[model samples]
Target: MHHSGERGERPAIREKSRGIWRTVTWRELAEEAAALAAAASARGLQRGAHVALLGDNRPRLYAAMCAAQWLGAIVVPLYQDATADEIASSIESAKVTHVFAENQEQVDKLLEILPRCPTVRCIVYDKDRGMRHYKQPELVSYASLLQQGRQLAAEKRDFLQAEAARGTGQDSAFVFFTSGTTGPAKGVVLTHASLIDRARVAAATESLKDTDVAMAYLPPGWIGQNLFSYVQPMVVGYCVCCPESSETMLADMREMGPTYFLATPRVLEALLTQVTMRMEDTGGFNQRLYRAGMAAAHRIDAGKTVSLSDRITAAACSLLIYGPLRDVLGMSNVRVAFTAGDAAAPALVTFFRALGINLKQLYGSTETGFFVAMQRDGQVKPDTVGPVADGVELKFTEQREILVRSPGMFKEYHRDPETTAQARNADGWFHTGDAGYLGDDGHLRIIDRIKYVGALNDGTAHSPKLLENKLKFIPYIKEAVAFGDGRDMVCALIDIDMAAVGRWADKRSISYTGHADLASQDEVYELIAEGIAKVNADLAQEPALAKSQIHRFVILHGELSPDDGVLTRTGKLRRGVIAERYRALVDAMYGGAKEVRIDVEAGHADIKVRDAEIIGHRQIRSAA
Candidate 1:
């Protein structure tokens, strides 16, 4: 609201609607929030009431959240891609009374679960498509909500401001739900002061300017996205652009050319795969040029360049290849590229650095308001997420589990005192559940989830996430599930990135129908086996992890989605569920079978039956 008076015309948020970009000024955003706050007050929403925001990244949703906080209400954003059942648990857990859904699909999910969730009395929808036939009493369009809000604002001129005055710094602002990778999602309650303080720290760390632009495409439910896109932008007075849809993310990123970028390890991997596939498809001079350029860049990155000839080669490569590639990836203007959501593979992070992009890593979680440790510019390390942020202290337990004390720490887990107590102690140290140690350089190096870190049958240490990150860094592989716990040897179920492998196949004129067909091909098996072999070769150097090398593997015939109970809505693997669901394949790999009869339903789509090659010591073929 202060920004509105300071710079009313400044663009606060931008969104692409129906192929055209639209901007909302700071002044307009403040009015919408204030009016919505007034209208929500009329709807019986008060301080401490929980309001739910559901859908993709949109300006209206951001306005609604601000409106919610204007009235001292708590905002809970549910992942747009989450199933109705998954959303129901979140709505029920928060006892959400009012929900602002982005579109009909989100509103429909709310209505479907409304009968069971009696507290949800009002549903405000942003877009009215496919909503004309609905005659639900709880349903109201965003247009209507705004009209009502304007009327209420006119009637009670100081209503919203008065309510805002009652809000305290200690009051809860958001309740971000955990990803539920291992169990049910827990509502992590964070306060206004906490998020605001951390946002400022992050902004100061980056020296963020009002001229800087960021794109918001990730789920609002994820704290990492919320922090970078919503909270930090608000604090730093930067413009956050929301893409039209997930399908248009890359195109939008190219068009907008944001100066700041944040993405998951998965997103980065996919982008790299896309670039690699594109390069491979052109397989002539361009392919040779890219390879030669990358080799020079790698040498430059390792400080192995000693001759003027080497420097000249690298500079030429930068002009011919790296510069154009960065422009194509829409990262040429990116000042600070951040990756979180799972510590990315060191190799993956270094790839962009080699291309002259300042890609860095951040180590934090939902419970920490998303800022604990972040790499500073010019001091980034591929293996470490930099030293702790200002006002944050980090320590490690005897077991190497990381603990943190940050000003941005969560207040508690909403209605889950026991879990909250377990997470934080009397000393105010928050147990991060992540296991890692500090490097001599004073940077934090995270390995994997403390509980998920385990050993093979021979007691050789194995970290599934580390291995999975390494696999995902491979262009052909997408998601991997490593199984070796109490087993004779490590075996993996590989999910081939359809787009990447499909492109490779298409480039070779290899005919295939769908994902299952492509995955079942012997050539695809050879590509995946090649990736695994490279990973094993790397692991062989580390004696402790040598035995943890994957000796056998099988390709998954279908995607592991949330509906299948094998993956959480946020893409975290339910390892137990996956292991049991793919028991036949897992057994076959260990049973010395040459192939596994993969029979898994493709998430309410169809029953897929395919034979997946169990590539082992004898079956593994060298990539041609």
Candidate 2:
């Protein structure tokens, strides 16, 4: 907020307000945050108390976050899409006594869960269009809260300033929950210094200017959002734009022309699927032109010389197709685009770089403030995460687990010192729990999660995540989970991309009503089999992974979703939970059953049972 004084009259944030774009300057942002801070103070939000922030991305939401920090309170950002029960768990865990709801939707959710959380004392709301009749004593309108703050300011002019001055860099700025693949999520406590330093280094590396624009779409509860939309905006004084809603993200992004962008592998996969589907829907001439342009682009190696003919073709294609394609994807102005949170497909990386997007893979975790290894300019490697980031040190364990130590390393897990001690050794090196190796050029190639890396019964090592990533690159497969740990052969559970595969089916005159019906179709199974076979062919090329080829596979009747507890909020598979939930299916594959009947819990309340045929396509080859 202090940056507002140094950089006056510049737009600090922008978002759609009532169907029109509304911008807030840095000066206005500070004023708004200060008022909110005073109001929160008036509500008995004392120092070190946790303020739960529940809402979609909004200018007022960001202001409240800053306000809470300014008043020396820790901000806890809850996922707006989480179930009421899940939100209650986070609120209870954090012992949050105050909540800042975005609108009536979130307020209703809070009200539903309020009976279970007795500690909550104040409920401050932003949008009150439909909430004029709410008479709960805890309920406070945003305008009224600001009015109270103004009255407090009149009585004590230095109250907010004094609170801000009392804050130290080591104080807990916020606590972000882990994705919780293995178990219940743990809160990772990050301090002001750690987060600020990480953002500073990143901004310096990218040479971000105050004039740069970035989209704020990722869930703010995640460290990535904090770094890109929150910390970097404050550090570099750039404008962070929020979309009206999740559905309008692409449209809003196209209009904003963000200069800096970061998206998870899943998001990139979706965008690629959209692009491919759109191209297939175009006329014959346009489809042929896209294919030709892509072929030309592929010929121009990212870091190598191109022949005169190939160069000319690529330039022509750029002018005719690739350039406009980028504009349509809202990446025409992206100075640096990254895909992280897990390994991105090498194919996706090559595809984007081939189109001149400067797309790179980044490697980090929530505990590291989300900056560890980043691809640098002219050092892009599709198979590696480039090099260790500035101000970070990395080493591998005997078991090949990556260990990181950096100035920006997190302080500890909130209220969980035992787990914190286990995460970091006495030397302050934090175990990343990811198995990887360093290339000759100092780039880091992540294999998979350390615990998930295993060998077959005969001792041929394989990485399930590595294989899964390869399968996901097929575009027909949306999610893949490989199982071979201590087993004789590898098998997989595949989730078809409903949109992409459905389109393929429609083009072939196939009929289907829903995901379940379409996935069960024999033709769809054959298509998935083809994709798995391609992955097997690629696995055969690797000497160490050949024996770990998928010997059997089954297409799931439904997608693995967070609602069913099969996936975490960040889209990570809860492997342990999945294995337990599908124990019967796993046994059938190993028991030599050719088919299995499985029951899938549709959501929190519905169960859907379906029969699936297990197909064994064992192309097990020996080490070359």
Candidate 3:
């Protein structure tokens, strides 16, 4: 495609920063990218050199990405929220020769690890926040680099053309690091063809249009963001909007009124919580209306096709109840809203649909270039991941592990042939490591990771993911990990939703110092006990899970965090890690100890309690 400014009249990117929407036209984007490419070449950077782009979402960052592609250079996007050590490790692993820092803080981090990353000869900064004191000879401002590129482009048009000409579909385009749930992050290399093919599939599957407005809120280093923000927009000619900051995402969403939205289940969960919390404070009239509308939603949620009478009632409800509610939540114009990265609660999915949002689930990974399966508009089923995308083949192994073969699959793990061989078989099927079965309708239902699925001593196989998902469906429980493999009974380590629990405590006038005090409080334990009992009652209805019901449980003193390696970036629980870390608590639960003294890591202090209650479920008698 020739570099045409014909699309310049249309907005390509609208970056909302500091409550201001800055629109960049397609022509302006092309010119800026060309200028950056010219400048990089002038800096003596080779065509195939690895360039690291580390920053929050910004127009300049996007420009750099396109520029790198135009020059046949590989762009490595790093998570801006990662710690300095994590950034250093990625920089060293990728052998990045040039670094692009978003602000002074990032520059400082790069400087801290500069001695380790000897390959990084140059650092280009964007925000210039705190670099005034450091007099690094290699440091250069992004603006100055763009100016130099513009100057070079003005003189050497032929050279720039030759550089841009070097780019091809076969060349390596980007490298995204996996979330590293098992070990150190692995670099999944994607060529132009790999990414572009998947983007085309996604565009066709979702029926993406030039008029669609996408909100690019997730970390750009992730494969999901790559598909939504970087690749799909280019393929479908859609406009991608970046919010100002993490805290400003909600406000930016309201202002942009995005037509296309994609977020992890955690984001949706939080939104649902916020909605419920706000509704709890509303008046009787509005609450009654909301209840009636939600009841109507529940009817549709139960797999019942809406009747004409129900549709009319629902339409009336949408106008008076759901429409204003959606507008307030900034989801009024949402044409496609996808929730992935983790499985969401069925009730949560139904809630959105009741409000007229076309929310659906999708399945993919970095190795697959992020497009594997997606639910179509009306064919969505809450219990299963939809069928495989066009041109993709999926099958289940004897072990029930889902395997995939697709055009968008990555070539190999960068510099790790042994690991690559282990992931991809000789027969061309890439082992997904996920345990799932294809339903009668051909939709895939993932239970858990195959590695995590285990059998009890009695030989009953259990899927922890399914049980955990059931537990999380309860509003009070934020996180839960069930452990019972090779044991007689399942037990759980539960993390209560602090906000919800605090509200409950406040209503009862139960005062506590913090999370630790609240968690250990007797009244709080009673509340959580009720929640766990409810979960057990629900689990008892399932044949496979009934035997795996939680026999003993304890509330965690604090929330699990990524910093502590208890939760992955995608918010999936690291069960093994948590099990090891809370060994004392686990022992106490099974060892018949009434109370246990635990050390709080935050304050480096030990907390002692006497005769703490361990909740157990009462077996329900058979109906006569």
Candidate 4:
């Protein structure tokens, strides 16, 4: 509303539909939000009410959030793809009475869970598809809601304005659910001041302006996405463009050419995998050129330029190769791209910077309102998440767990002050739970979770999560789990990428029935072995991690998924669950057995352990 008063006619939100961009100016956005607020208020919505929004990055969804917040309601954004059971906990915890669902799919999920969540009084749906048959009294279309809102506004214009004005800086704005590796998601509460203050600080630090634009492609449930798309844009008055759907996200990003972009490590790795596969499919000449250009780019990224000829060749390669590659990946116009959520491979980070993209790392979580540390331009390092963010107080615990006290830190863990107390200290420093150190260069370098990372029996440092992340950078490997916490050597359980390895197999005429069949294939194992070899080579270059290189690995029969309880809703591996489920396979990998029993049905595919090829094919006998 503030922006609307200042720049009412400027584009605030843009949504792609039917291959065309549909924009909503600041004035229109404010009007729609106000209307929704008036309508909800007319239906008994009040300040401090909890509102659940289930959808992707839709313009209407953002408007819905604004409307809810305007009435002093705490917005709880659920992952659009979450199942009924997955969201039932959050819905019950927040006592969400009003749900703004994106479409029939989301509405259906809500309907399935409504019996368990009887507090839901209204379900406002945006799309009308497949909704004609529904007879639920709680269901209402968004258009109808707006119509009611318009009527109320005509009679009582000041009502909505007064409601919006009642909101205070300390009022709770959002309740973000963090899906940790092993828990029911925790609802993190953030106040309006905490969220807006950090957004402004980051906006100023980055020199962002109203002219800048960004794509909201990832799941809005993530706090990082909420900050980058919803919170920051409101603070900076920048336009946020949403893609039509997940399938068209890349094409939309390429078309919109968003000035600012944020991607998770998984997203970045997927883009690189696409580039890798495309190059592998091209002619020999193009493939050779890509390799040479990337080699030169790597040299350039490392600041190892030697001669004038090197500079000339690299510049020509950028024009001929990297430039087109950037365009295809929809990052050509991206000014400052960021990667977060999880640790990214150093090589992967360097890969983009080599191509002249200002790719940097961000370190934070849902608890920090998603801004704790960030890499600044020209101060970027592959291994660090730059320095602590501006206006943030940071320190280290005795165990080296990163502790931060930032303006953006969450107010509390909703309804769980005991857990909150365990995380945040009396002095306001929130324990990040991540073990890391601040180097002399003032950059924060993360190793892994304090409890999950330790030393091997030989006293060599072991960080399985870090090792797993690096191995996953290989296009052929989708997920890897490292073991040998107190053992002499590290071993890994692997999950192959169905699309990537399938395409590779098709090109080579390798026969396979399914993911399980592919894993059982000798050739597929060899391919994965080759990928691990490359990871080992890269590890050899890093003195601190070389001793912890993967000694043996077995490709599982299938991918880890949330449905199977092996992965969380946000796709984080449930290590304890996986270890327990595949105890036999783990034993076989360490016992030097040639094979382990497993189940592979049409849907349920468990770990299919085969003899893990040793690093040098020397065959690992049971390590006693």
> How close is every model to the real structure, measured as TM-score?
0.95, 0.94, 0.94, 0.96
Q: Global lDDT of each model?
A: 0.85, 0.84, 0.81, 0.85
lDDT of 1 by residue, 1-624 (tens): 888988789999999989999999999999999888888888888889999999999999999999999989999998998889888998899999999998988887888888889999899999898999989998888889898999888786677668878999899999999988777789999999999999999888989998899999988899988987888877888899999988888778888999999988888888889878777777887787777777777767655645676677668868877888888887888998899887788889888887888898998988987888889886777888998899999888998999999999999999999999888999999999899998888988998888888887778777888888888888988899987777778888899898888888987899999988888888888888888888886676666676778888888877778778887666778887887888888888788877645544553322222232333343333431
TM-score of 1: 0.95
Higher-ranked by lDDT: 1 or 3: 1
lDDT accuracy of residue 70 in candidate 3: 79
Q: After superposing candidate 1, which stretches have Cα over 4 Å from the reference? A: 303-305, 601-624
Shift of residue 484 alpha carbon in model 2, Å = 1.3
Taking the tens digit of each residue's C-alpha lDDT, what string does model 3 give over 438-484? 89898878877888889888887877777777777666778888888
Error of 4 at 420 (Å): 1.4
**Is 3 or 4 the stronger prediction by TM-score?**
4
Badly placed stretches (over 4 Å) of model 4 are 541-543, 602-624
Question: Best to worst by lDDT, what's the order?
Answer: 4, 1, 2, 3
Question: Which segments of model 3 are wrong by more than 4 Å?
Answer: 1-4, 305-313, 602-624
> How well is each residue in 131-237 modelled by candidate 2, as lDDT tens digits?
98999998999889987877776565588778888999999999898888767898998999999989998889889999999998887777887788889898999
Off by over 4 Å in 2: 283-301, 600-624
